[model samples]
Target: MKAQGVVLATRYVLVTLIALLVILPFALMFMATFREHTDIIRRGPLALPQHFSVDNFRKVLFQHHFDRYYLNSILITVPVVGGSLVFALMSAFALSVMDFPLKRFFLLGVVSFGVMIPEVFIMIPLFQLMHGLGLVNNLLSVILPSLAMSACFSTLVIRSFFMGLPRELLDSAMVDGATFWEILWKIYTPLAIPAIVTSGALTAVWTWNTYITPLVLIHDPLKMPLPLGLALFQGQYVANVPLIMTGATLTALPPIVVYLLLQPRVVLGITQGALK
Candidate 1:
């Protein structure tokens, strides 16, 4: 009994230590946002500031045009997350529940081809396609391609969720003379919200932080999203550390806010679908 208690206590201590290590840097950054730049530099990131200043956030929001980038981020992330979720759910539903030839082949294709293909390898082709459409500096360039591209992991996850639904529920819907579209709308979609939220949360973060695609396709400074905007906070000799930290903190809020709102669904989805 004593031996088991010691082992459990040791495990708890290890987990706590690991969690603190993971959380400390973000905590330091959050604190630094309210501190003066000189204090941050003098203290070497570990010490507290002499006084709290909202000046960093104020300057970034007002003087540096961070608000526009924040808005741009929202415009890009919202559509991308919504479109990706819709596309993945619809495709996964058909792939998971329907009877068709090349069904296995298609699933294999999603798993194999989608995951293995590196974005770098296709960047040149993607840029050319964007240029041809005259979408180089447009938000549509980000939104449209995001909609069309398949996320294998999301498809796999939603497929698992769809597979877990009782076979009879779908059959009963069909027996009632419901069409596929009707059944999908009235039944499947409502039931799939939890899983969809999980997928949305994932897509939201990725689309928000997208740097390379925007860098290659976006030429206008005013149109750049938050990650690209961070570049402006850096200078040759003296980096704007406080302002950069402030930008990062502000940029991080939206996704975290979205996640908090949908956290229940995420938890429920994972718990319910864990076996799959």
Candidate 2:
């Protein structure tokens, strides 16, 4: 009993220390946002703030044009998350429940292929395609490709969950005259909530934080998303550390909020999926 107690205590202590190490930098950054830039420079970021204010946040949101960039992110992420969820669910449903030929080919050739290919490797072709379509500086250029990319991965996730569901349950539903769409939306979808949220949350964060794709395809300031817009915080020679940190904090907030809102199901979905 004593040996087991010692081991458990050591585990808790180690976990606490690791947690602090991970959290302290972000904590300092959040606190520094309330302090003046000059104060952070003079006292160091580790020093406690002399006063608390939201001036840096205001400056970042209004003076720095982060608001426009934020709006751009919203416009892009919303469609990617919502649209890709629908596509992934539909494709996953067909793959999981229905019998069809060429199914394995579709899974391996297209879905797995999308997952394995590096996003950076396709930038040139993607850029040329967007340019040819006159979507070079349009949000659609980012939205369309991101939607497709997310759908492929999400399909795999939801498909695993669907496949794990009991065969008898689905067969009984069909005997009761449930149509394909009816089984998917009314039956599997409700049961697959956790998997759906997991995929949606993951896609939302990826789309929101994407820098490379937008940089390659978009040049107009108006079309740039939040991650790309972070470049505006630096100059030829100087960078405002606090201002940049504040923007970084704000940029990271939405995904964090979304995940927390759906955290319980996300955890449940991941756990169940792993067990399967």
Candidate 3:
């Protein structure tokens, strides 16, 4: 018992140390946002600021138009999340519950091929396609690609959840003359809420933080989202550390809030999906 107790104590200490190591940089970044740029430069990033000020945040929001960038992020993220979830749920339902030719092949393609291909690999072709469609610098250029990627991954998640559902329930619904759409809406959707929420939250975070796609496709500064907007604070010669950190903090908050709100559902969905 004493040996086991020592092992447990050692494990706890190790985990706590690792956690602190991982979180320390983020904690420092948060603290740096409240410091003056000169103080940060003089004392270094780890030092405590002489005075905590919201001035950097004010400058980021007002002078840098972080609020407009924030709005653009919302406009992009909302549609991507919503559209992805809607499309993924339908695709998952078809793949999970219904019988069709090449169903397994399709599922395998989504699970394997869709994820294996990195978006960066196709950015050049995607840029050409978007330009051809006259969508260069358009928010839809970002939204459409994000939606497709999100839906592909989300389908795998939702399909796993749907497959775990009791077969009898779907059979009973079918006996009542429920069409596929009716069964999907009335039966599968309610039971799969946790998975849906998980997918939506994950998609929202991915879409919100997407920098490369927007940077490549969008040329208009006004149309730029938060991740791209954050770059505007950095100059060729001089970078405003405090203001940049302030923008980072703002840029990070929404996804953080969304994850917090949906954390319970995400945990439950992942746990149940794994068990089944």
Candidate 4:
């Protein structure tokens, strides 16, 4: 009993230490956002601020037009997440439930291999394609590619979840005159909410933080998303640490909120998928 108690104590201490390591950066950043630039320079990043103020946040949101950039982020993130999940769900359903010639080949050879290819390698070709399609410097350039790339892993995750589901349910539904679409929507979808939410949240976070794609494809200042916009905001406020940190904090909020809200579902979906 004493030995077991010591082991449990050690585990708790280790987990607490790791949790602090993960949280310290964000805690410091949040504190820094409230400090003035002069105070930050004088006191150092780790030092407590002499005074806290909301002026930095105001400057970032109003003076820098971070709100517009935020709107742009919503526009890009929403469509990419929705479109990718829709494509992924349908593709995963087909792969999980249906039998067709070359299905295994497509799943392994194409989808699996596609995930291994880095997005950086395809940027140039993608740029040319976007230009050819007259989508260069447009939001579609960013949104379309994000949707396509995100679908690769999203499909795999959802497919794993679908495969874990009882085959008898689908087979029984079909015998009762249910079409593929009806079975997918009426039966599979209702039960797969956790997996869908998990996939959507992950894709939303990725799309929200996407920087390079938008930086390369979009030129209009008004249309840049939060990630790219924050970079520009940082450049313009290089000496102003508080303002820069404020922008950083704001940029980090959406994904943090998303994960916090759906953390349970994400954990459940991943564990269930992995077990199957």
Candidate 5:
């Protein structure tokens, strides 16, 4: 009994330590946002601030023009998430239900391979294609590519869910004179809530944090997203750590808020949808 008690205590302590390690950075960043610039320079990062102030956030919002960037981030993330979900649903449905020659070859050669292909590998070609179409520096460049790339995981997930659904359900819908569109809209859409939330939230968070493609494709500061805006907080000689933390905190809020809002449904759906 004593040995078992010791083991349980050790496990609890280890978990607590790991939790603290994960949380400490965000906690310090929150403190740094309110810390004076001089305090940040003189004192170590973990030190308490002399006076807590909202000045950092003020500077970020008013001085840096992060409002526009925030809006831009929203615009990019929303379309990407929504479009990805739509495409993923259709692709998954077709892959699961539709039968045609070379379907397995196409799935293996194209969709399966696409799931493993890193976006960075094709950045150059993607840029050239966007440039050819005159989409460079335009939001469409990001949105279109986002739609094209989306979450391969979502396709796999939705496909799994679709396959698990009873064929009789689709057949019944058909018997009732439901077209493919009706069956898809009425049945699949309603039951695929979990997959949608799981996929949409994942895509949204990714799109919100998208930096590399935006960095490469966008030279126009005004057209950039929150990630790009956060970059502006640093300068050559002096970096505004407080302002940077404030900007980062603000940037982190949207996806967190979104996740929180849909968390219950997301959790429930993933659990239920995994079965059928």
Candidate 6:
């Protein structure tokens, strides 16, 4: 009993420390948003401002056009998350239950391998491809590649859930004169909600924070998403520490809200998978 209590206490202490480690940077950013720019620059990031104000956030959001950046982020993130999940679900269904020649090759050689390769290696080729398509400076330049990448991971995760489903369900559905298409949508999909939600939430978060793809492809200030926009905003306001942190905080806000709201579904998906 004493050993168990000791282990539990130590485990909680470790988790609390890790939680603080993850949260401290955002905490600092939020704190800095209300602090003086000069206060942060002179006294470092940790210093308390002599007076707190909302002028920095107001300037970043309204005067400097962070709202435009926010809209650009929405334009890019929405299509990527929606399209990626659709592709992922269809592909995952085929991979999980359907049979076809070269199926293993496509899964192992293409999809799995694509995930292993770093995005940096393909940036040049991706940019060239986008340029060839006349998509440079267009939001589609970011959306297409992000959708494809997000779909790959979503497919892998959704497939596992589909594969775990009982074969009897499919056999029974078929006996009732249901087609494969119906089986996929009418039967399989309902059971895979947790998995789909999990995939979607993760995809949404990644698409929301996409920096590299936009950086490599998007050049127009109007088309740039939040991450790139924030970087440029920081550069333009080089001396204004508080304004930079305000942009960072707002840019990071959406994903944090998304992950929190969808957290229960994520946990449910993992729990269901584990039980299976």
Q: For residues 165-229, what per-residue lDDT tens digits would candidate 2 score against the true structure?
A: 99998999999999999999999999998788788887788899888899999898877899888
Worst 10 residues of 6 by lDDT: 267-276
Q: Tell me how far candidate 6 lies from the true structure as C-alpha RMSD in angstroms.
A: 3.1
Q: Regarding lDDT, does 2 or 3 come out ahead?
A: 2
lDDT of each: 0.76, 0.86, 0.85, 0.86, 0.79, 0.85
Residues forming the 10-long window of minimal summed lDDT in candidate 1: 231-240
What is candidate 3's TM-score against the reference?
0.90
Off by over 4 Å in 6: 1-14, 39-53, 264-276
Per-residue lDDT tens digits of candidate 5, residues 1-276? Answer: 999999999999999999999989888888888987778778877798788678878888887878879888888888887877888888888888777788787667776666666668878998899899998998888887776666455677788779889999988888999888778878997898877777777667778888878877887888989888777655521466787788889988777788789888666545654453
Task: Name the better of 1 and 6 by TM-score.
Answer: 6
Question: Candidates' TM-scores?
Answer: 0.86, 0.90, 0.90, 0.90, 0.89, 0.88
Residue pairs whose backbone atoms clash in candidate 3: none
What's the C-alpha lDDT at position 73 in model 4? 93
Steric clash pairs (candidate 4): none
Better of 4 and 5 by lDDT: 4
Clash number for each model: 0, 0, 0, 0, 0, 0
| Candidate 2 runs further than 4 Å off | 1-6, 235-237, 264-276
Give the 10-residue window scoring lowest on summed lDDT in candidate 4. Answer: 267-276
Q: lDDT of candidate 2? A: 0.86
- 46-138 per-residue lDDT for model 1 (tens digits): 887677779889998888888888888889888887777777877788887788888888888665466456556677888999999899989
Question: What's model 6's lDDT at 111?
Answer: 74
Off by over 4 Å in 1: 1-5, 42-44, 110-112, 150-153, 235-238, 260-276
